[model samples]
Target: MAPAIMLAADAPKLSSANTGFMLICSALVMLMTPGLAFFYGGMVRVKSTLNMLMMSFISLGIVTILWVLYGFSMAFGTDHGSIVGWTSDFVGFGGIGKEDLWPGYTIPVFVFAVFQLMFAIITPALISGALADRVKFSAWSLFLILWVTVVYFPVAHWVWGTGGWAFDLGVIDFAGGTAVHINAGAAALGVILVIGKRVGFKRDPMRPHSLPLVMLGAGLLWFGWFGFNAGSWLGNDDGVGPLMFVNTQIATAAAMLAWLVYEKIRHGAFTTLGAASGAVAGLVAITPSGGAVSPLGAIAVGVIAGVLCAMAVGLKYKFGFDDSLDVVGVHMVGGIAGSLLIGFFASGKGQSDVEGLFYGGGLDQFWKQCAGVFAVLGYSLVASAVLAFLLDKTIGMRVPEDEEVSGIDQAQHAETAYDFSGTGGGLVGSAAPALAAESKKVDA
Candidate 1:
């Protein structure tokens, strides 16, 4: 115990600069939840817009409380057989000190914990997009609690926690390709399976009510993603941080272009929705491989993810699942493409020491990447499905069809997104003059 204490002391002293940087990154990451709210809200119909926003916003409230209680400890605490960490180490942050430095890092443990908490908050929120306008808000909220507890915490440990199985096996998830995006994506697929299709999934003309809102949300996500990708290094002064920053920009641009090209060839129009979705695809793809691949590799990953995800969005129509916002397609497919492509494109000269096939490495690293990807995918799928099934049987998971069609925002939240009733004295009082003038002009 004395030697252990001494080694802990001898580890790198906490740096004020790194701590401040991490705190800023945490703020940036926290903003992403609200950004996600706007993104999903705009994609939904006007009737369901508030519900969509609430779904993502609620995660910020619920997950933050859980993380403070035990989520952080479960994910990042002392290892327990590489499957999970012992929650007793930091439950309620018990025994952690203000000056306590994270193991082998220059930041305070509390700052690191908060940074991780932001990641945990946004992850489950990512799944909300798939269930829009159909699920009971109460059931969805409860699902958030159980899913994070059972699926997210354990998977986070398996990938990013010290002494985690995948970490020990040298899996190169620089950010959260497998853990966050893939985990959330697979979970999205699983829950949608249990909940079944929306009332008008194929029959109704359910288009976005507000593209400007969608663009705003997407822009915010793009800005906040800089911290998401580069801040994984825990410091900005490193060469890898700059590389990730540049790669993120390059990949996102390439993906948006690729998606636009695909849209023009396939649909004859380059829509704003396609551009935004493509950017998100690139962001998801580069998240895991940013620290491992070069700029050119990032472009390769982005273009592939763009084309594949664009094609994948149509699959729900073919296979008959109601992923309302294409979360499974853009996130899950992009994450898989990024994680697996690392086996082919990782440059040893980057942040990680391992090389990929294109960098003169062999199939060994590729296989390891595959193993990590499948492990998370399988676990998230099973765990999320079971949880959704139990909830559906017991407390009920979806709203009644009438409530869904009439509007989930009013049914679930008792409020609508827009009060058009207030528009110029109930329309007649304000529009009477314009209508009369148009009638006069027609008579003339």
Candidate 2:
């Protein structure tokens, strides 16, 4: 009979175990945003810390609603020849419930929906750091909504959704090398180009306000990553989950060591920032190849990512692109390193069907991996540039010069994060110096 009616029969079944595990995974990923908030918040000048936190916090609420609506359909619907998804699956989710079927699992379609929803939420937030302290809060919120619909949905369709070109081509992104990291990394580049650099990009020291917050953020990210990488298996299979878990740990630990060593050699000090950044670099590298590579391979990926990213971060000064926070160096470089390394490590010579040049499997799989990396890099950069241009034209990008000097937190949001624990105010709490000055300016 009808195509919709017929497709219903192809739907899979839902189970409690799958549902529980996935929900937990979703929560773990959700924690990443706040972790990201702290990570980014510490990097900005103190004048804008709260604003950075708000940018990330808002994504949790805004994207969640959007995902439940057309966002899901656009990303996951029946694919239309590698470009985008058709809306035939639109509102088809209404019928999905606790007992409904998901393609890969016995979990409810809703659970799958929520799991993917967590991804959608974090991707846009990842780009926020690049635009920090310049754009209006309202404009940023609007940009995130539009960017998710335009840039994120189509990319997600191409990478993760059924019949996606990447999937069909056998590109193995265990979690989000292409879908999350590359996609967001490219978007960060686009926004940075349109917005220009933060005030005093090269001149200002702009040290992180709190190293403790950065460490906390790194810890949370490392914790949540277990879910991000392992849960990609979509279920508690006999060995895949444990394997991914071990790889995640090994890679992160190795990357941390690699980064610390690099900092010691190059900078003459093993700063806390280096360790935290190295751990993240390792995590990004492991994400793509975790499922495909063995434990030893994972360590190799981590070490390479650490050293490569450490080197890459210094390129911003030489090339002078101003990534603001090194999104390109760590995520983009690390993603490529991990994805390509798997070609050698996973080729059946060791623990997988694909072998690398080292294992004597030759260059075939390596080339395939290279092809995937270039494809993602090229597509993402071009698509992201176009989207940024469109938004820049329509809504205008970046704030006025005056606002940049005054601090976005006070100028844009009309608020400040700290009042020195109320010690800065006196005599009936004369509204705190910063707050009182702003009130007087408003009245005048």
Candidate 3:
């Protein structure tokens, strides 16, 4: 790609390079759901693994359909009172044409729509980790439908949409600190409250069955996050895109190190789980701030997120709320840190003209960041709590105690994650005959 492809002021049009880059970024972001599946799956007990995987996988199907039909319109259509977009503007993607470009950008409107669709798909999936093992699959599916409509769409409009309340307020969510991570993290806490703790809770060991799977999932998430953070720029030609990409890497590395160091000092050992969680915390922190911060700033954000998220994970045990996979800890805390830190770390030389406090800009940007974080956090918590309570009172939110103990994978899906019974294997059958003859001889 060219270092910079400047478009003429009078005759702006689509660029093939930007379109292809965004399409690839969309695909990369889509992969994160399955990556989340493996990540969450490996963290649960053996019996609940399939259910864990399914929770993340289900969003890919549900959200894609919803996005194409109406979610996109509600999020990015004509502005409506600075709160949401007009559903009539792009319902069914009705008014957009093949030749149309995204308002001021060089990519097709469809490319931007699809890119945003990937974001919609993963936000609900992020909550599944908190509701793992005991949730009814049907209820979870229904919740996905409801949550995206009531929570994700409106908040997305508030942050990313044109003329959005936060956008107009200059909240500066470079990616989705407010719209995605904080939104999902707060929702996770709400649902966990309504669902109650797992059957085992504090007593059960509940060790991860597969660390390898967790590592693999973490790797995929780290890889895909490049597209997630960088692609938010909506074009490759801007200098900010590369800066965001490098910042993402730097921050993740720093966060991982910070988490490992904290683990070594606090827990007596550096752990694979800590490394993975740390990396995720870093990624979450940089999502909203990467484009605006330098490498050094990214490192500061990453180290802070890693250490804080590491401590935050223990809050579930202390507070008596069971966030199954630490979504509240890593995503919410990290997102809040990243977003708020932008007030102090944002550089005027970067994408936005706003300079943060560290560069002598004072507390103006910091306060705006705080406002955005609290708005999304408060809205998501209330909305998600109400939805979860309603679902629990109506069709029910959790499985029966018997199902919970017996394994939800079988109860919900009627299939286990692993079946060890051999297909009358040739080696086993041959060994069985020899063993029987030896037993007969011994008896004689």
Candidate 4:
């Protein structure tokens, strides 16, 4: 009996259940990129649909390779002064072994690495929506290479890596409120500022090419978000993962309802666009707060996010910076709302001991969340802007004016999202705007 007990004590650190769960979660998170592609693709003019989809799909290929090369090292390797991380061990996934476990978790280091890679993949893809129709595919691709290397890897280190400044300072980003949503949102704003509007700012009717595609994309995002949020807990060893799961569903539902309500009251009808964007807002808000708040708190966060994001979407017309797909309104504003609300909605009983303002924890946690949120927001905005500027000056970020005005999908990818060869004009379906405008010149 004593020999058997001693042998049992020397078991592998890996947990098969947790490992399997994380693998599933990684796959789910990976699905968000395609979901995002569809969402953005549907939101743009038909001429830009394939281009938009390609923008996101390209990242899956690009980031996966980068993550395997050095992204993981920069993000999760040993910290260097709390700003970035470094370690030769993870560079290329060479030195690591299958038996290696992520410290403080039961899953293999490989599982955690791949899981985090999914996040690294999707964050930059989120920015593509803002630059739709106007950017050169090659330029955007190069920008991703640099942006992820410079902006994402470092911020990820700060927010989630061991000994990270935000992690050490007790920021309450349950998943990626700061690192992913806000980071991408701010970056989107920066790029749009550099690239300017898509030919006809307010004069053109840039309605979505397909709402059904948008809804389908939104549904996929909402479904995959369960893994994105809940899987961040790393395992179901406790109730935090399950808690996060329930809160995710609750918050998303509330946000969707709130958006529809606001739309009906203000616009006289509940829009499908509004519902889709609202659900995403809730997903964004709950991303950083799910593990820290109660179900009721999730509802409040969702409602606030839906209303705020719904209102914020109109700011592009007000401010005159063309965000092609409202990425800034929905992601940046939604991310900020969710991250900041952690200070108010944190229940102090879920994941951490810190209490939010309503939970008797006062403004302390709120302040911490602000620091984390604004720090990431500020860094991403400035850094992303600088990257875009560099790209603009070097290879020229915007497509040629004729290509954009006629059809970006055809010009850039050499193929259209739909076939119009049977038409008298040949490809006239994709080039409807050009045929209408004829020789008219846009006021660029």
Query: What local distance difference test score does each model get?
Result: 0.91, 0.81, 0.91, 0.93
List the pairs of residues colliding in candidate 4.
none
Residue 80 shift from truth in candidate 3, angstroms: 1.1
**Tens-place lDDT digits, model 3, residues 293-325:** 889999999999999999999999999999989
Off by over 4 Å in 1: 1-10, 423-444
Q: By the lDDT metric, which is better: model 2 or model 3? A: 3
Query: Which regions of candidate 2 fall more than 4 Å away from where they truly are?
Result: 1-13, 87-92, 347-352, 421-444
CA lDDT for candidate 1: 0.91
Q: Taking the tens digit of each residue's C-alpha lDDT, what string does model 4 give over 1-444?
A: 999898768754789999999999999999999999999899999999999999999999999999989999999999999999988999999989988989878899999999999999999999999998899999999999999999999999999999899999999899999999999999999989888998987998999989999999999999999999999999998799999999999999999999999999989999999999999999999999999999999999999999999999999999999998989999999999999998998898899888999989899999999999999999999999999999999899999999999989778876677765664433434566675576466532
TM-score of 3: 0.93
For candidate 2, write residues 102-192 as lDDT tens digits. Answer: 7667777777788888889888888887777787787788888878887788878877888888777767778888778877777777667
Residue-level lDDT for 382 in candidate 3: 92
C-alpha root-mean-square deviation, candidate 3? 6.8
lDDT tens digits, residues 73-156, model 1?
889988999999876859888879999888778998899999999999999999999999899999999999999999999999
Clash pairs (backbone) in predicted model 1: none
Highest lDDT scorer: 4
TM-scores of all models? 0.93, 0.89, 0.93, 0.93
Comparing 1 and 2 on TM-score, the stronger one: 1
